[model samples]
Target: MGTLEGRLKGKVALITGAARGQGAAAARRFAAEGAKVMIADVNDAEGKALAGELGDPAAYAHLDVAEEDDWAQAVDRTVAEFGTLNVLVNNAGVLHFSPLGQTTLADYERVIRINQVGAFLGMRSVVEPMSTAGGGSIVNVSSVEGLAGMPFLVAYTASKFAIRGMTKVAALELGERGIRVNSLHPGMIDTQMVSDAAGGAEVDFSRVARRLALQRVGRPEEIADVALFLASDESSYCTGGEFVADGGATATHALKL
Candidate 1:
């Protein structure tokens, strides 16, 4: 449905957290665009089911982004199955909400380990294989939280900020190798992550929308549209920069106004 649809014809991709949410949406979109996709996630049942639904035997792997060995093996398996690796979407992440005072070391550690370290490992693990396969693109799913602070999500915010910082450095370091690395700063989209962060709090979607220049929370597919562009050659000249797909959430000081 996007302009970049099918631009990745015959390319292969390995997407983490591909069982659901943004990851699942990206996987389906990538495959629809003619990329042989491997949906990797810790959720065995859902991951396997998604693979079946994609109807590609070699298109899924049980991956826990937190584990180094698992990350390496997933890339290996993907190469074995698909014969190449052209894209890596580091989409596996968890959102934990808590005020600074309520945030424990364990909670903070878990958040960073999954959200930040996971992407690092994914990039590191894929470098050699991707290099051998003649370079590739790495798309990291960061958050608008990385651009600004949100109350009660100290750990999540910190982790995403770290991802934003790391992504730039990774892009610079990998560019010479013919690989392009970019991070996506997604605005609050409709997904379970937002639901959990909202946590039954009294809120107004209308007010939230009015604050945005676009005046609305975006859909998962809307974010996927940007992902598709980044994944395909349409964005060939882009790297080491963030694509903010937020619905004008960061466009102005509307919240303060």
Candidate 2:
């Protein structure tokens, strides 16, 4: 009968790509739950606006995920602003649709650098502060594509799969240090990243939604709930695990029409 109040009270979090979409949703939830949040993203305007809207509970930081210096600065700012860093949600990523033969090395590396390498840097950067704070959680935002292959997504698949694997490795290595690492796999969430990747082309998710068991595309706020759980102590015993939030998309078999 008790309300879920202050679930993240006294906690501090840094979320990448938080200017909008799922990351932004998580930011709002974290703030409402009594956590200090840092909205880290390359989108300066939106990031700053979100931080302002969230008031003192949030701050904006410009972070180009693939850059080491940017990672360092973002981590430092989170600690300096919030007094400690207790959680990190590596939610920054770009989706690219390209055939295997046509996928450029440049494009492949770009996806890997942001989605894959960005998570790597985030985990590495937070260990020291999080350990000093006595413990923390790392939520790497992967995709259902990480679990299985999808057409025209070789690079994105590779990056998400790497995130899934790296999460396990980090969990094993960091458990003794009081840090928990896990991967979050979301399927077909309605977000701007897809449209942006398509060069502002209008996307029709109704067709895709029809194939889902839920028969609808996901919402960013939905995934934010899962991220909130993983970030909170509610998932204390849940490290090195895959937390999937797909709409039963993965439940189908190859023979499905």
Candidate 3:
């Protein structure tokens, strides 16, 4: 059980793509802060393992974010287990790299379905439950690409930008219901997402590090910290905003070498 003193004590959260990486990080942090978490993912083994590791108040739900039925089931299970839904983290995403000319419709739609449509479904699914709970927070994990363009990542860029746009729209529409929606734009972080897009080729972060104002790749834990603030009461006044943790990637213009 989450202690009474924890920031998220009594709150329940559903985190997508939580079997590993950033989703896993947020799950741990939220649990430590006293929130009950539903670790939703397609990877059953890892998701089950994580739920076991988190113990009481943390459970795993198999969710295919692209499927609307999966969304309904996950939300129902969350409410059934924890009693109410208060926080949602739409963190499941895939990265694909190809020139716009080389990108196939299938490839582009795949990214949009997971990153964009999934988020839309999540927001819609939670509205009624969140209203019942008096209010809630939604964190949509976008990328720096959402802020500006990047080469060979048209599909991913489009999905993230759509997430950014949808966040604001949800915020405006859901405010009366006491639900807040916000987007998180992260810079080059040390995560497996990019390498997976590169067919498992290891990324050399040194070159990218030199261009960042922080001179280092961001960590999953760091982004989790920002997410923590958004999930808790700390960001109550914030809604429909772009909360960026991109290591100053957007500070420089395209003209910069």
Output the number of the TM-score-best candidate.
2
Q: Write one digit per residue (lDDT tens) for candidate 1, span 62-112.
A: 898999999988999999999999999999988887889989999899989
Q: Note the residue pairs that clash in candidate 2.
A: none
- Superposed on all Cα atoms, the candidates' RMSDs to the truth, in angstroms, are 2.0, 1.3, 1.9
Candidate 2 residue lDDT tens string, 1-257: 01699999999999999999999999999999999999999999999999999999999999999999999999998898889999999999999999999999999999999999999999999999999999999999999999999999999999999999999999999999999999999999999999988889999999999899999999999999999999999999999999999999999977889
Per residue, candidate 3 scores C-alpha lDDT tens digits across 1-257 of 23335889889999999999899999999999999999999999999999999999799999999999999999999999999999999999999999999999999999999999999999999999999999999999998999899999999999999999999999999999999999999999888887898899999999989998888889988888889889999899999999899888988987777
Query: Per-residue error at 79 for model 2, in Å?
Result: 0.9
Instruction: Give me candidate 1's TM-score against the actual structure.
Output: 0.93
lDDT for residue 6 in candidate 3, whole number 0-100 = 88
Against the correct fold, how does model 3 do in TM-score? 0.97
Q: What is the model-wide C-alpha lDDT for candidate 1?
A: 0.86
How do all the candidates rank in terms of lDDT, highest first?
Answer: 2, 3, 1
| Candidate 1 residue spans exceeding 4 A from truth | 3-5, 197-204
Decreasing TM-score order of the candidates: 2, 3, 1
Error of 3 at 1 (Å): 16
